[model samples]
Structures are given as C-alpha cells and as structure tokens.
Target: MFDCIIVGAGPAGSTAAYHLSNQGRSVLLLEKKSFPRYKPCGGGVSPAIQQWFDFDLTPVVDNKVNRVRFTWKKGDPVETELDTTEPFWMVQRDVFDNFLVEKAVEAGSELQDNSEVTAVQISNDIASVTTSKGKFDARYLIAADGASGAMANWLGFKEAKQFLGAVLEVETAVAPAERNTAKFEFGSLKNGLLWCFPKSNGYSLSAGIIRGGKGKVKDLEKQLTNYASELGINLSQSQFYNYPMNLWSSERQLHQNNALLVGETAGIADPLIAEGIRPAILSGVKAAEAIVKALAGDRNALAGYTDTINSEIGSDLVLAQRLSGLFFQFPGIAYRVGVKRPYAGKMMSRILCGELRYADITDMAMQRLKSSLIPGRG
Candidate 1:
C-alpha cells in the first residue's frame, strides 16, 4: 500500500505527489487522461506560485502578461500596466500539468496516466481505488479529481453546487502587443464575464456564470463567438469546450476518515475571477503537509487542513464572493467606479497574482461601489 493515493494529475495532485515523495512518503498519482491533455481554462496563473517549489517553471510558462485591458461590452476600455513584483503568467494547461507531474515522477512519485478510476472505497481503514487499470490501496487518499469528478460523492462529502463554464481556444499568430496584454470584457455575459489570456502559440477565451445560477452552453458559446468577433479573431479555426465548475460557497468538512479533498474537488476556485491554479496548488501543498503529519501520528492534522483552508483561503474568498456579487450585479457601474481607475485596475491584477488580498482593498472598494449607487454619484 502506498502512503497516499492522489486522484487526478492537475496542479493539486501533482504538487501533493512531489511534496509527499520529497519527504520520503510513497505517493501514487492516478490520472484519467494521458499526458499533455487539454482542459477548458483561460490559462491565467499567478507568478506567485513560484514560491511553492525550487524547480524552474519558466519553461512551462507560455507567456507573462504585464498589461491588462478591460472593456465593457467590447467598448469603453480601461487599460493599464499591472504594477506587481511579477507579471501574470499564461500557460497551456496540458503543458503546465504535464511538467508538474513529471517533476513529481522525478522526485520518486509514481504516476499512472490514462488510469481512469471507476470505484473507490475505504476498507479496513485503508483507502482503495478500483481503476480501469486495477485496484490500488493507500493509507490515505486525496480527492483532487476536480469539480466534475465523482470522488467527492464516493467519499460522502455533500458535493458543492456547480455551474457550467466554457472556453474557446484558437491557435494563431498574435502581435507582440496582444501577446503582452491580458484582456477581459464585462457586460457581455449576464452575471459573468469573458476573459482572454495569451498562450505562447494561441489564446484561450473563457466565460462562465460565476456568481450564481446556471448557464446554457449555447449561450456561453454564442457570447464567446461574439466576443471573439469583436476582437477580430476568426471563429472557423477554434475549438470550444464546456465543463462544470464549483466555486467556494461555504465552509465544509474537507477531511473524512483518511481521505481528503483538494483543488476543484474541494471547491477552491476563486469566486470573483474563477482563478484556479494558484489556489489548487496551494491546497495541494497543504494537503501533502497535513498527510505527512497524520502519518506521523498527528491526530488533528487532517482536520487542521480543513481549518487552514477555511480560514486562509475560504475567508478571503468570502470577501471575494461579496465583491463578486456587487461587481456582477451592476457591471456598468462597477466598471466605472471600481475598475476604471488606473490604480484600481492594477490592484485587481495584484490580487490575481497573489501579491494583494481582497481583505486589503475590499472595504474601500465596497464603499466606492456603494457610494456610486447613491444619487448621481455614478
């Protein structure tokens, strides 16, 4: 039996594998898909993730965008250069995920790609997974299989509510100006937003109803098409995908028995921008630490993981949730008062890059938004 079995090879799972193996624990990482697989994402990652490991991640980062351009319904742009210690990173998920998993393997963690897990259970206090490849046993299990994965259900955690998110990716040559700027458009999707981040060889355009309620796939695709058209991109050579995602809604028990949840499976996606990579990696790092402690007879380690995430990440996201509600409800007004200011725009970028916290600026932002709604201030 392995010390830990990590489901899914996304940032969370691979990160756990690397750390656990580095600490001399046996880790087995199972992935449903082969290496270099694509996922529907905007591919925007905070460069702040560099603190997690000593290995070089520069080779996998496709682009680093310093400039940000925000628009309201494809017009009235508020553009500025992000003033953070490091620029935002743009990556292709396939490349980035594979690179991390490879690092884990290099660190003595075992990886079994294309091994789709069909069943999971806890028997005799050992967590076991029955995959298409076969059954594997572990002292601990990390459910990092993402929002759509069934590991949460198998582990008996009341699943988080999810909404459909869509992405349209296109491969084409881009000018240097476009490559260096990350783009966002508000008021194009109801209660949601559309974002485009550059990849080394292409662009991934993502849209989702992040605040609340469900979204029709057709509606998201249509809006993305229109947004692409407005950006002068050709639709004939693009691929579109739809996936379900869960954002942080409430604090819940993330640990059960010897099993724990991480990444999207743990409902850690950012409520405002739906940022996933940094949070997923952060959860993975913490999960590995908690499991290592548990293996050493730390009785409260797993529960502490839950508490740490709830307080550190969930608390911040709660602020983000409130801000997201206010921002999405009145996109036009928020764009004018909150985002249009050059400093505010840069601060938003800083938040995304992990340099700033919502708690740092949300109070002022809330007052600004609330005041703008008064009389003729807007």
Candidate 2:
C-alpha cells in the first residue's frame, strides 16, 4: 500500500507528491491525461510563488510582465509600469504542469498517466482507489482532480455553492507595442473582465464572465471578437478554448475520513480574478505537511488544515468576495474613479504580485473612490 494516493497530476497533485516522496513516503500520482496535455488557463503566476520552490522556473516562464494596461468600456486604456524588483511571470500550462509532474517523478513518486480514477472507498483508515489501470490501496487519498472531477461526490461531500466563471482563449501574434504587457478590460461584460496576456510565441487573448450575468457565453465571445478586430488582430484563424472555474467558498468541507481535497477540488480559485495556480500549489503543500504530520502519529494533524487555510488563503478570498461584489455592482464607477487614479493601479499590481492582500487594501481603495467621486474629499 502506498502512503498517499494523489489523483490528478496537475500543479496540486504533483506538488503534494513531490513533497511526500521527498520525505521518503511512498506516493502514487495518477492522471487521466498524458503528460504535456493542454489545460485551459491564463498562465499568469505571481512572483511570490518562488517562495514555495527551491528551483528556478525560468525555463518554463514565457515572459516576466513589467506593465499592465487597464481599460473600462471604450475609454482610453490606463497603463502602469510595475516598479518592483521582480515582475509577474507568465507560462503555458502544458509545459509548466509537465515540469511539475516530472519533478515529482524525480523525487521518487510513481506517476501513472492515462490512469483515470473511477471510484474511491475508505474503510479501517485505508483508502481504496479504483482507476483505469488497477486498484490501489493507500493510507490517505488526496483529491486534486480539479472542479470538473467527481472526487467530492464519491467521498459523500456536500457540494459547496460556487461562483462559476467561464473563459475563452486564443493565441495569435501581437504587435511590438503589446509585447510584455498584460491588458485587462472591464465593463465589456456584466460582472466580468477580458484579458490579454503575452505568451512566449504570441499573445493569449481571453474573456472571462461570471455565470448568470447580463449576457450569455455567445455575447462574451462576440465582445472578444469585436475587441480583437478593433485592435486589427485576427482571431478567426486561431483555435478557441473554453473552461470553467469554481471560486472558493468558506463553507466547503476540505477533509473527511483520511480523504483530503486540494486545488480546484476544494474551490481554491480567487473570487475576483479566478486566479488558481498559486492557491492550488499552496494548498497542495499544506496538505502534504498535514499528511506528513498525520503519518507521524498525530491523528489531529489534518484538523489544523481548516485553520491554516482560513488564516492564509481563505481570509484573502473572503475579502475578494466582498470586493468583487462591490466592484461588479458598479464596475464603471470602480474603473473610472478608482482604478484610473494614481497609486490605485499600483496597489492592484502589488496585489497581483502577492505583495499586498485584498483585505488590507479595500479601505484604501474605497477612500480613493470617495476622493474621486466627491470633490475636495480626502
């Protein structure tokens, strides 16, 4: 029997396996798809993620963004250059994910690609996972199979109410002026935003919209197409991809009966921006730490996971949820009066870099809005 069985070899599962295997514990990482498989993502990673790894990620990083451009409706875009020592990094998900899984393998974890998990059962403190390849028994099971996976249902966990966000992305050549700059446009969709991120070979243009919004998916696509055409970019020749993200909720149950959930399975994406990579990696690392402590005879080790996430991750998401509600409620005012103000964009850039928490900046953002909306107000 393995010490831990990790489902899905994405960032979360691979990170957990890497840590567990490095501790000399037997780890089995199962993936439904082959290595280098495509995953729908913007692929923007905050520089703070460097704290989690000891190795350099330069080989996988497509670009280090130093500038951000924000737009509201048809108004002139406001551009801001980040003044930090290190900038945010962008990568392609397929390459980045494969690299992580390879690290897990190098750390002695057994990786089984094309091994889709069909079912899981826990009894007598042992977990039995049935996959396409075969059945495996382990002391603990980590569910990192993402939002679309069925691990939560199989484990009898109640489905948490999640804010569903959708994305449509394409890659195409960009102009010299667009290189190395990330762009965000709001007010095009109700309660949503569109983005353009620079990739290694081209630019990735995407549109994100919250579910049950003013427009449907088709409307969002039309907006993106029109926006691209306005910029003289042709998306008709590019391939289109779509995916959904499940935002985090505090009420979600993370662990039960030696089975723990991590990554999208636990709804760890940011409520405001739908950012998932950093939280997924962090949750994976925290889950591994708990598993290690539990294996050392601390039955209550897993219990601390709730508190840890609350303090480190959940707190920020909670603040994000509140800010998202306020921002989306009046995106136009938020954009014109808040985001366009001096230092406001910088604060957001700092937030994206993981240098400032949303909880800490909400008040400052409100004050900026007030000063802009009401003349002679500080």
Best by TM-score: 1
Clashes of 2: 0
- List the global CA lDDT of all models: 0.92, 0.81
Question: What TM-score would each prediction reach against the true structure?
Answer: 0.98, 0.94
lDDT of 2 by residue, 280-351 (tens): 999999999999999999888777775687778988888787777778777877887778877878888888
Candidate 1: residue 299 Cα off by (Å): 0.9
On lDDT, the candidate that comes out on top is 1
Identify the runs in model 2 with alpha carbons over 4 angstroms from their true place.
162-169, 211-215, 367-378
Worst 10 residues of 1 by lDDT: 228-237
State the displacement of the C-alpha of residue 152, model 1, in Å, after optimal TM-score superposition: 0.3
